[model samples]
Target: MSAFPQPAQPSLFGDDGPLRDTREPVLMSLNPVYYDLIWAGEKTYEFRRRFLTGQSVRWYVYLTGPVGRLGAVIDLGPAVVDAPEQIAEIAERTRAGNGASVFEYVRDLDQAFAIPIQRVAEYPGMPLEQLRTELGGFHPPQGYTRLRNHPDLLSICEKVRADSVRREMTVPGH
Candidate 1:
């Protein structure tokens, strides 16, 4: 017998249909510093130069550089597109002392996107080396890549999502 018990498989469908029918899955690379803030729940909004609006998105967060791993999945609400200054105002309102740098990042842009973080699920992580080995070769995205475009990556994300679901179900008071 195996030393560890296998986790229960997550159901793909609910009463309506697939559980993830509403949100599109996408892989997004984040700086280790910013990822740390998100992990700590200090960062509530993710500011981007551009992103999909009017729809929810599930972000498979890949921490770049030394970490070089996909460590967490974040469920994001619809993007709030607005002027850079206005986006900065949101950062300042939500979390003090965060607006200045956020403004700096998007100052040159005509419009920016403020993606609200709804939930975060952390996993053990998949390193870059392992990902490259599994998918033949993997290139971390500069912006974002739709999971649908890459079947292998999509499968990996699905497994992570399933694992997260299982973990949540098993947790007390979930």
Candidate 2:
């Protein structure tokens, strides 16, 4: 028998109440081109304006395209909101994508925001079907969303956290 017991199936609601877990998860969909850049550690800043809440939070990066998959999780730093020119300068200095491109994208917006990322984990591609199963029916967010009230996602996060702890505890020579 396995040492780790199977995780219990997640219900629509938890024992405490309607899922009100504080740890928030944002599901972000990115085009494969940018996703590849970020995944390769070439791009450090995810530029945004409308979708960003200026909060330092963890994000689940999902690659959307012909190859749709949940590929990585990142601890995003607090959003740095500034003028378009400054934002472009930051992007040019620290990121892989073109600064002019980023400037053009956010020039019309009130303020441009840069969410710096530190990759905590890189997960093998989980297909949309599997993600739907894990998330209890998922929709690709056009911008960003806080999965604060999602019971299924919260449960999955618990399992993932537990598994991560186990992996970290395992002795290399054992």
Candidate 3:
């Protein structure tokens, strides 16, 4: 009776390619300003001081403050770890007006991560209050929390991802 396809049913991407099982998803808190950029497809890379390298990941975006909701999921490519200047170069090459800010953010660190945004899926989000009520007390992560560590949250994300895939499949020319 459920509208969304079950996870174990079949390949959402098609028969030849099953969904690539990336590393466990992470819940990341984002400032509303930057979250808007990401949602609008203006921001191509997410700069991080520390993050898992060598693996792709799905980031469950928790928009902080005025927008206190888990609003979107972003699929990210493997992180590009490099010197601050080098990372800044990537920002400049990809999107204009972000290079200086990116440089400033990573300047103090020896190395930084430039996580490429592969895809983004927006959905009707679970608000913070509702999440806390459902989870019996939830705090948005300051750094990041692996979804696997919280089965409840992981289950929610899985459903959302499945629905997103279904929508993509139904969309013409997807």
Candidate 4:
């Protein structure tokens, strides 16, 4: 598994009480949410390639906006994002208004669907600095489990994730 430089916070989902467990953040990544962020980029093709390489990233359940195609950064290496159509689809079927969004599904998906890792987040909009701040001194909460048990849960397929990102960040690119 590739560990990110920034420590990730456990995603929280609901108010304290019985309904709380269901509000956890769904752990997702480049493998699934990749294409959409690229589509929203000013340099879509270039961004797409970098993301495929590994530069952009999104934390487990942080809020990422794609207002009218204005994609926000979630995954920073190649930057990953969830698209509108993807969100709309879920909203339509579940009447949940955002079932297609990872944010939406995160709160409602059956526990069986918890792949990668799932954590209860305080909010989907938790900022990166905030996550770092909150998690900086956190000890695992009661009855909580972590997915880092098996190292093989993630494997970086190639050097692209970083190589591609550097290509774009250089002064020449601008």
Best model number under lDDT: 1
lDDT of 4 by residue, 17-120 (tens): 45433322113323224333333332122111111222222333223333112012222233233343433343344333334443443343222121111111
Off by over 4 Å in 2: 1-23, 51-54, 134-136, 157-174
What tens digits encode model 2's per-residue C-alpha lDDT throughout 9-125? 556665344444433477677787876666565677788866556466767767787877765666677778888988898888875457889999899887888877754465554
User: Candidate 4 at 66: error in angstroms?
Assistant: 22
Candidate 4 yields a Cα-based lDDT of 0.27
By descending lDDT, how would the candidates be arranged?
Answer: 1, 3, 2, 4
**Cα lDDT tens digits for candidate 3, 19-49:** 5564559999999898667656577788888
Tens-digit lDDT track for model 1 on 1-174? 889997755565652434435788899999989876765657888899989989999899888999998878888889899999999998887779999989998999999999888777778778999888888999999998989888889997776556533121111111
Which of candidates 2 and 3 is the stronger one according to lDDT? Answer: 3
Going through the candidates in order, what is the number of backbone clashes in each?
0, 0, 0, 24
> Which scores greater on lDDT, model 1 or model 2?
1
TM-score of 4: 0.20
| C-alpha lDDT score of every prediction, in listed order | 0.82, 0.67, 0.79, 0.27
- Looking at model 2, the pairs that clash are none
**Which candidate comes out best when scored by TM-score?**
1
